[model samples]
Target: MIVERLIIADNQPLTAYAVEALSRSVAQEIHIEDLEIAYAQNKTQLNNLLRDGKKTAVVVDYTMFDFTNQENFTIVCDLYQNTSCWLLLSEELTPNFLRYVVYQTQNVGVAYKDASLDSMREALHYVMTGVRYISQQATQILLQKAAEAENRRDELTHTEREILKAIALGKTTKEIAADRFSSVHTINSHRKNIFRKLGVNCVHDAIKYALRAGLVDESEFFI
Candidate 1:
C-alpha cells in the first residue's frame, strides 16, 4: 500500500468518505486532516500545512477556493514541488483546461466527485508512479484537443512543476497546505517565483503559457 500524507480542504461529508476510502485501500500510512479557512483567518490553515517539511501528496475537493487564483496556484507549484495531487472536480473538465494543467503541474491527476474508491485508488497509484491520470469520460475529450508536443528542456524546477500541478488541479494556498506538507508563508514565497518564471498572473494564464511552451504532452496524459 502507498503511504499518502493527505489533507482535505472541504469539511464536507464526501471529503470524509474519500479520505476513509483512501486510508482503507490505497495508503498504508494515511495522515488525514482538515483545514478550515475563511477569508479572515490570521493565517490560513492550509498555508500552515504547506509550510511543514514532510513531503506528502494531497487529495482535494475541486470546489475549494483559497488557491483559486493564478498567484495562489503558482505559490502551490513552488511549495509542494515533490508532491503529487488529486483534484475531485464538481463536474466534467474541459479539454483546454485539462491540457493546460497537464503542462503546469506535470503530475496532477483528475477524478470526478462521483468516482469510486477504486478509481481514486488507481489514480493515486498512477500519479505516484509518475504518470498522469484522467477519468475515462474525460480521456477522449482531452485527447481531442489540439495539443502541442511537450518540450522537456524548458521544464520548471521540480518544485515549480508541482505547484503548477496543484493549481491546475484547482487547489488554493490554504487547500494546498492541508493537502501537502508546507507552510502558508513559504507557499506564498513560491507563488511569487512561479509568476515571475512562468510570466503569468493567474492560473488560466499560467496554464496557457505552460501549454504553449510545450511543457505538457496530451498523448501521454491518460484520462
Candidate 2:
C-alpha cells in the first residue's frame, strides 16, 4: 500500500534531516518541502499544497508564521477540514498554545519539538490509521493546566478572563494583538496578569487556570 503523503512545514535545516529520517522509516518516498526561513514568503504555494491533498498529513511548526490569522486559519482548517490527518510540531505542549492549534487543526495530531524521532514517527503512523496522537508530556501538561484553572476561580477579572480564554484557546500573542488591535507587548502584559491572577508562573499554569475556571473548554485545547 502507498503510504500517506507526509509534508513537513519547517524552515530549519535540522528539521529537514530529522523529519526526513523519521519519514524514511514509514514512507516509501520522503518528500521535503523546506521553506528554510522563507515559509511565509509563498503563502499561495503553501495554500495550494495543502488544498491538493486528498488523504494527507501535514506537520507544521507552532511558530510557523501566522496560522492564527483568520484567513490562514481558514486555509489550514480547509486543508484538514475532512482529510482526517494533520499534525503540529510545537516547541512546547503548553495548553495555552496547543488549544488554539488543535482547535484549528481539527485534532489530527500534536507532537512536541523535543520528542524522540520515534515518537513523532509513531504519531504519524497513528494518524494514518485514523487515530489522533498527542505526546505524553503534552497530555500531562493539558490535564495539569485544567486542574490549576479550576483551583483558581475568583481571582480573575472579566478582561483577564477573556485573555485567559484566548490563551487557552491557542491564540498567539500576535494573533490576539491583531484581533484586539493592540500591541504584542500589551497582549504579553495581559498574559503576565493572567499568570499572576491565576497564581501560576507560566503559560502552562495560565492554561490550567482557564480550563479549571471554565473560561475555555478542554476540547478547545490540546497537544
- Winning candidate number (lDDT): 2
What overall lDDT goes with each candidate model? 0.55, 0.64
C-alpha TM-scores of all predictions: 0.50, 0.58
The residue-by-residue lDDT of candidate 1 on 1-223, one tens digit each, is 1223555555566665655565445444333234221221222665667566445445555445455654455456456666534444445555545555566665456777667767767766554344567777566555444332133315467777777666655579888776668898877787777776654456676665555554454443223
Off by over 4 Å in 1: 1-4, 28-43, 83-89, 127-132, 147-223
Candidate 1 yields a Cα-based lDDT of 0.55
The total of clashing pairs for model 2 equals 8
Task: Give per-residue CA lDDT, model 2, range 1-223, as digits (tens).
Answer: 1224555667676875677566655553233233121132235555666565545556666476445553464456565566635567768545656655554455457888788867877876665445667778777776786567565567667777787788888888899899888999988887887776565666875676566667787877875
